[model samples]
Target chain A: MSESAAPGIDTAFPLSPEMRAAIIAHARREAPRECCGIIAGRDGAPVRVYPTTNIAEGNRFYEIDPKELADLEFRELPNENAEIVAIYHSHPASPAYPSRTDVELAFWPEAVYLICSLEDPDKPYIRGFTIRDGQIAEVTLPA
Target chain B: MASESTVQVLIPTPLRRFTDGESRVEVSGATVGDALDALEARFPGIDERVRDDSGQIRRFVNLFVNGQNVRDRDGIATPLSPGDELGIIPAMAGGSAA
Candidate 1:
């Protein structure tokens, strides 16, 4: 029930080069199908990117396996004093922007949404945003 | 019939607002549905977020009892035991292309 206080212009999605590379690698590895994951963070900065299974049954959508998400949210991240700061998914062949489906299914308003686009195959574009109350606002993904 | 048992429900961060910031709360219920009803009794409007208008568990909202999905068991009818743990996990779903 989080309201419209989605992270705005000030909040920084500091994705490290290594983590960025890992996401791109996951996207490429998953290929035609979409890849999904979450970034664990502490104090508002990203610490790790965990590649999760996309159990959506097709390539056009992604749904992180509930078991994995529960483990992270309930056990893993808590022990580290970290939380999921960002959620990432691959577009496969579309641009690095949130599609209508992404906006609609975004229930976690606190976590920044990162979309990695493999439109060109060779060049994967990654962008970050916050979707809350059906409104989308781009957030800076500090390279 | 099993008596109502007190169990711990884990409230994820996203739903913590409705829980008044309490990550975990103890509720007594014979089944998952009863526990949720008890939760809603304490935190108004939270049940709607987990269940649809027909009172069915939402597609994207997953309820797990001690790491086991309730859907795999008896769904909302899944019985609870004393000190059982229920986890409400909002599925992280969606994709960029269409």
Candidate 2:
């Protein structure tokens, strides 16, 4: 399928263990409140994980800082010839799934959405999905 | 009066569908609003995603000129310079389970 074949859903992209560990670590550090970040990739594969600030008013939601996003898009990513392959956020007390609010705010239809659930602090569960036009489809991750 | 200037608007990933998969587009305007108007004229249906019904920049969309946020400047009224870079970035946001 073409890159834009399905909009925001990469049907064949896989994640690395290091990257998964990074996300899990971030979720643990920001426990009780949501943590969020970006997975930068080059040539359809991940190269870096940017642990971004969650600027929302409360723990129930997450909004990345605009300045950090600007720098990543205009400078870092361009310099590295990388793009945002996925966007990951944590759910301190919920399941590893897209919430109703997540589906509603999933504006980047081309980005894989990764959700890390800290519901079981001892075993953080991570899952991936693609949300477009208020629809959600699960994507198997961590290959 | 300042002359209208040509600037490049960087289209983020999500809005690329409206921009024909283009990452950057050139437009002319004296201010950010004018540039946005030109962009919409060239690529229909994009204005609504970036701005609200009231013509205000959507709360979740960030408009930056030369890496400086318009919100920190003069909002839509932020002035543009020749060869300036404007970026339309959708805020990365979401929440937990239902």
Using DockQ as the measure, the top candidate is 1
> What is the fnat value (0 to 1) for candidate 1?
0.82
lDDT tens digits by residue: candidate 2, B47-97: 999999999999899999999999999999999999999999899998874
Residue pairs of candidate 1 with colliding backbone atoms = none
- Candidate 1 versus truth, CA RMSD in Å, comes to 1.9
The CAPRI quality class of candidate 1 comes to medium
| lDDT of every model, 2 decimals | 0.89, 0.87
After superposing candidate 1 on the true structure, give the runs of residues whose Cα lies further than 4 Å from its correct spot.
A1-10
Q: What does fnat come to for each candidate?
A: 0.82, 0.80
List DockQ for all candidates. Answer: 0.77, 0.71
Query: Whole-model lDDT, candidate 1?
Result: 0.89
Can you give the TM-score per candidate against the true fold?
A: 0.95, 0.94
What is the C-alpha lDDT profile of model 1 across A10-116, one tens digit per residue? Answer: 25677889999999999999989999999998877678889998899878989999999999999999999988888999999899888999988998988889899
i-RMS for every candidate: 1.4, 1.8
Place model 2 in a CAPRI quality band: medium
Best by TM-score: 1
